[model samples]
Target: MTTVQEQPVSTGGTPSVVLHAAEGLHDLIDGHGDENDRTGRIAEPVVEALYDIGAIGVFTPRELGGAEMTPRQAMDLFRTLSYADPSTGWVTMAMGLATGLAGAFFGENAARELFATPRLGIAGQGTRPGRAVPVPGGHRISGEWSFASGIKHCTHLHTAALDAETGQTRFFIVPVEQVTFIENWDVLGLRGTGSIDYTLEDCFVPIEYSYPSLSTEPVTGGDLYRIGIGNFASINHGGWVLGVGRRVLDELAAVVRAKAGRPGAQTDTVAFAEHFADAEVRLRAAKALLYEVWEEIEATLARGAEIPLRLHTLNRVALHNATFSVAGIAQFAYTSAGTDALRRGTMQRLFRDVHGGTQHVSSSPLVMQSAGRELAGLEEGKRWVHFSLK
Candidate 1:
């Protein structure tokens, strides 16, 4: 188990503090992988270690006492953690994004109330809109949501709901106590995420606690929030794919090196070497493309301009390429590792995690198709609203 730091981590303009913490926790996180997989949730010590390092709020607004890490910094942070353990990286991503959104969208009163605590972790799903009925002071939300990643360790929940009368999807922040857990998170990969089902039974959420789903206008914070949640999510997903891909390749290399001296080893052949080189190029190229796209987006945001359709289109394409490219690389690693990958270990777990991550809506075939349509100038006058070109 990892030892949680007694002191709070500093976010004093030094992203290295967070990244170093992530790198240092590799052994501890990897050590708990089996336990996390078996229990369908991350171990408490690992979770505490992450919180102690202030990783749970990597993307939250800096003014609200979060790291508010830049795209490059956030990418490094996520990549480091993911390389240590995919599930740990995944849970951190979910919580960080959720907490950042809460700080960005909520009103002053809600923001103060939410960020009042020293440690704040938020987890919930927004893909499926729930029903929200308006009342005098607030809305009554009632619906079942799936894939609430990291919910078991969260202090608050951020869910999306549709107001039938207005046809508007609104995001609401509710205390974890207000929601009911269904606890059906059994899955092949990312089991440590504990992304189980949950329900809100006519939960009364105040007007101050909710924000319009498609609004890019933030109640607080600067450039980061301006990119909107969709783009933000893409950045995180891209980082995670890069990290997981790197780890898979590294592990495969170790296996190949160990087998190199064996008599008549198949992995030592020229053909195998060429194939491995190609895999390296593919993963490296994918990562470069992702970083390039983010750099462009960051520049646009810094200039106080809305991210153009072209950039949004490219962002989605970058995520798609990164994800599928990593998936291919992982496949190559597994096939190359042969029977060794069949045993229950890092290679096996990563194979499942990569496949499971591919199922996410961010990198779905439909989303890629949408990006293609935009790139081909077929979606004129349309803009991205979440994963779709609206």
Candidate 2:
């Protein structure tokens, strides 16, 4: 088996500063993960550390004083952070994506004003479009959105609303304080994410702060933004699953080693050894496939060409495989570790986190089926438009 010290797919650029910062916070985040889980929010100290390390700005444009990491670098950063703590990684992923995309979509004046802070954090739901009535200077939006991850620590929100007049969906950037947060984040895992429900009542968002939902054209960034939000989010989810999967396996390995000297250890069997090797290979294969897809997309974007239908379809399938395959690996680790994973500890938390990851819309059965349709050439002249073949 290959060593666990695998490096992320590299696309020749300056080394990632965000990756180093994520590494530095590993111990701190892991230590407080339980506490953060209990509180249904990331511990204050951990949140502060994320902001101080500039991890929340991983995806924002370089010109806007954010990291603007390449897709590969961003994936590595997410994997590193998630390996430390899944909840922490999930929150950071939501905030970073929302903030960066908002900046990319908004006009220069709005982006300059909104992202002026070095530690800008954003959260909101892009699916489940709300209502937006056209007004004189802007649109008055009113609706509720669910699973606004990282909303507890965010400064602004990026919500989707359907324009009543134009019938087109648009994303409105609003201050977090303007919305009423519904305290209902109770769930099976990643509790520290605080992905609660939120509502806006007649919130007026200026035209400059709103952009079409499908617009890949960025006003403040480079080619990365041109890939659209769906593809960008896939990178984050893919990296997160890989990290959590690695953690589960690594924890199980440590447990097996610690019990090796004990008499008749459950994991001492030859069958368990073979199964462990299989799990490791599965995860490694998934990671390799994910990176391969991203690397090709990176090369394409660098050449100023639009992403082809095949690449987009492959991105979805790659993420589906990464997520589900990791969950399978986690199941193996948990079962092989026996009662050790059942107790309240890192192993248990990781098992829960990995399963929680499997429920994300990005890897839902419908999305997978959609990808399959594309790959089978069953949807001729149809292209993927946000998890669907249309």
Q: After superposition, how far is residue 85 of candidate 2 from its true place, in Å?
A: 0.3
Error of 2 at 49 (Å): 1.6
lDDT of 2 by residue, 142-231 (tens): 999999989999888999999999899998989888999999988988888988999999999999989998988787768888898789
| Best by the lDDT measure | 1
TM-score of 1: 0.95
Show pairs that collide, candidate 1: none
Q: What is the total number of backbone clashes in candidate 2?
A: 0
Q: Candidate 2 — which residues are off by over 4 angstroms? A: 1-15
In order, the Cα lDDT scores of the candidates are 0.86, 0.85
lDDT of 1 by residue, 1-390 (tens): 111122222332346777887889999998998788788899999999998888987877766667778887898888988888888889999899888877878776667777875567899998999999999899999999999999999989989999978989998989999999998987888888899999999999999988987767777666777787888767788899899999999999999999988988779889989989999999999989989999998999888788899999999899899999999999989998988888888899998899889999999999989999999999999999889999
- C-alpha RMSD values across all candidates: 4.5, 6.3
How many collisions per candidate? 0, 0
